[model samples]
Target: MAYSLVAEIWSELAFGMLVFALRFFTRWKYSGFRGMSYDDLFAVFAVTFWILETVSLYTCSAYGNNINLSVESALAVPDSEVPRLILGSKLAYCAWIFYILGIWTLKGVLLCLYNRLTMGLQQQRFVWVMMVVSVLTFLASLLWHILSCYPTYRAWQIKPYPGESCTQRKWNYVIICVLDVVTDIGMMAIPIPMLLRASLTVRRKVSLVLLFGSGIFVMICAVLRAYYSLVLIDDNTVALGWAAREFLVAAIVVNAPSIKPIFSDFKKRLTENYASGSWKSGTGSNAMSSGLPPYNGKNDIENNTAITSGNHKRTQAYKMSSIGRSQPKSESQDHINTATDADNDSTNSNIGKDGIIVTTEFKVSRR
Candidate 1:
């Protein structure tokens, strides 16, 4: 058995699964219906296919991989183990298909994310076109692989029957591998045009591009896999390692951006909680001396809408010499004015007592 194949699958999935979990958690934190969006749906699809690939790989391991035996020698293996070997071959076929599915779904996931980030109608149209083309190419590649050998089972069968010979052409797969690279490049380029026009600072735009940079590495993997696809056509046993790496790399690329918000959220909460904890309890020298009000167990929040407009008369009633005080016309006037004055006074008083949040703005009057 080739232990290296299993090890490859193990390493890639470990990192992929960690980011997958983070993506799910961040989506849930931001929205209740995480799976409702197309992006999340694609994530679910990719994850399902990846899990199936792992199962298929484990089943393939039951038989000896890279046994290094001649056809005669392989056929000579004990009848009991021959079935295991054939079974493993079939599992490899299934795992290969799962790898394709996982990569395709991830491409969709990336496109959907880019679609959300872009603003122009025309840009969105281009994204939709790319998405459609990507799906078509994947389907074409899948069809080619499945139907490459007549009766499909021959695609993974150990040998030809007494009369019927199975197709074992490696060149047929080269097309798929080449198209894989092209589509990956296409997916990577779809958002660059819009990203270049973003109003954000250079640092943010660079980070955004770097977020999509994983695709470039994935393209490199596809090139390697292309070479291995030929190797696979010559002999299928040599491909488990290559396919494993391709699947993992594509996985990490699609998932890399979705997990960043989780890190930022964690950092923000930790800093705010630490700062709040630093404020000591009590009034006067204990708390007010530091300019931070003492925190009462019950801290009621004041919303922005409750703030008095700049037009509201100042709470302190100072009678100017030019405007002598006049008597109120009625009890109602006195009642309303007095209540208004009282509320405004209370807000100013709470500046020191409940000054938990402060918002400032600058304005230049047209007059």
Candidate 2:
């Protein structure tokens, strides 16, 4: 059982680190470390605490081998084994502290994202309010962890069989679970109004909503973690496993918006390669023989009257406007819309007549 728990912890650590690395790489590719936003800094801190938590969990489960040890059961352990159990209990406490730190730091990241997305909009005020609430709740959660068991040393008491509050810390789980869910819901709320008001097709709007609304999965994980933590009070391994899963989900949710650049890069390369292949196959010559423009890079841009690239692209059919701004213009209007792409790079617009379509990106400037 201990070996299995160790394997699970290692797996979580590997995947969590991978997600963080990809997130940072994409961000750095577009904006160097100096260009990183508050959310990116928050992610750094979150990942740091997560690494600490992972180390603590691994040590407690693998070296201590102290799963399913109730307070009463712990009192009967051999003298030599007692020290191991005590150490495990202390490590478990440290792991929860690290977990709390990582979780709240992620909340800060989400709030930073919301603040940036809602800049120059009425929703900005709501974000400020949520920020205040999040700070207070985080303090409350941290204080609960520090003061819940009382005289903290009892948390590691094995001989006297300290109360369940000290051994299991049930109230801490409940408090953190409730507060975490509330903050996640608040984060999800920030993007909805902007998405609804934007002049986007239903399909695009739904996709954006689903992307931002991924927090629902994290909330579900929180609830299950709390449920099993209380239900299986003797098995710290189960609770730790659930907490790791919850953190993994939250990390993905926090980074999903920023990782769009890598995908956009892949799509651009694929389109360029496909067009290049067509020209090399003499398809261009055949099209010219039939008095039709061949499918080549130059013709592709000329036909659409738009330049597409990994960093920036211009589209005639769709125009993504800034938040807190007017809807996209009609085909008759000569208005130009400059969209901030996944790489945070802007492009010059070209004149074209097409139906209105809108998308969104996070920009720091207010207009």
Candidate 3:
């Protein structure tokens, strides 16, 4: 039973560490570790507090848990265990509160991301409203958690005390659970209508929907956590494990999106490496820069540039030349010269499809 408690702590800790590594890597590599956003800040806070809460859970389990025992056996617990139980109970209570904060903060991370994405739309108003309501709910929940018991201190009393009373929080916790799931669903659905109306292709819309749909998985985790908490609410040890698992899931759900750009960039780099390695001669000084096999001299480089600059024309000529051997060779050369003349006559402001799009952009100018 004690091992079970420590196992949950270890599991959550490992998950948190793994996410933290990814988050940190993403920020360092993509964001240039500058101008941190609300989501970034909330992720760090959620992860840091979750780790602390895990340590607290470990402390809470220092004394062997009394979960799932007969009522009679629970009553017969030795007086010597009470002090240790009280200490553990206090730590567990602290962890419970921190866990709630961590979940809320993690939710904030996603909500903030949504807010930024919808900032220029009518739905932005709805996003702001949701954020306000979530904050108020979080504060109210915190207040209720603190004052959850009569005489408050009685809530943490490992031993029974005369003239002290406490209120059962089973239904109260169920209410919190319902609120969490509802809010999660609302947040997940907020972008759909707007995305549908946007000037995007079906493929883009579907991708956006699926990206936001990830929150549904987090909602499932919340539902399961609620079920377990309600069922094992009477058992401290079992409840602690559920709490840890729920927190880890929330952390993963919120932080996963932030690392998407990192994975995309890595994939892009691999593609570039493969393409360049296959197409370019590795022996040249500018080998890595070239997308095609090695050329002989400076003349070759200039000729290659000219060919690329007017690839559509070259391709057209090549196709025309292949169409019939009866076509005169001088006519093909004439076509190439005309294409070269057209390239020289073009300007940046009047660029055509043959011109480069210049995809290499300053990051600061992008969304």
Best candidate per lDDT, number?
2
The local lDDT score (0 to 100) that residue 219 gets in candidate 3 is 78
TM-score of 2: 0.74
Q: How well is each residue in 86-110 modelled by candidate 1, as lDDT tens digits?
A: 6776776677688789888888888
Off by over 4 Å in 1: 1-3, 34-36, 64-81, 159-169, 228-238, 269-367
Higher-lDDT candidate of 2 and 3: 2
Alpha-carbon RMSD to native, per candidate: 16.2, 11.7, 14.4
List, residue by residue over 178-288, the lDDT tens digit for candidate 2. 988998788778877667655556796787779878889999999999999889867777888888889898898878777765776677668767663322111110000
In order, what lDDT does every prediction score?
Answer: 0.59, 0.69, 0.59
lDDT of 3 by residue, 122-176 (tens): 6778888889878877777666667666566655564443121232355546766
Comparing 1 and 3 on TM-score, the stronger one? 3
| RMSD over all Cα atoms, model 1 | 16.2
TM-score of each: 0.67, 0.74, 0.69
Alpha carbon lDDT at 278, candidate 3: 39
Record all residue pairs in model 1 with backbone atoms less than 3 Å apart, i.e. clashing. Answer: none
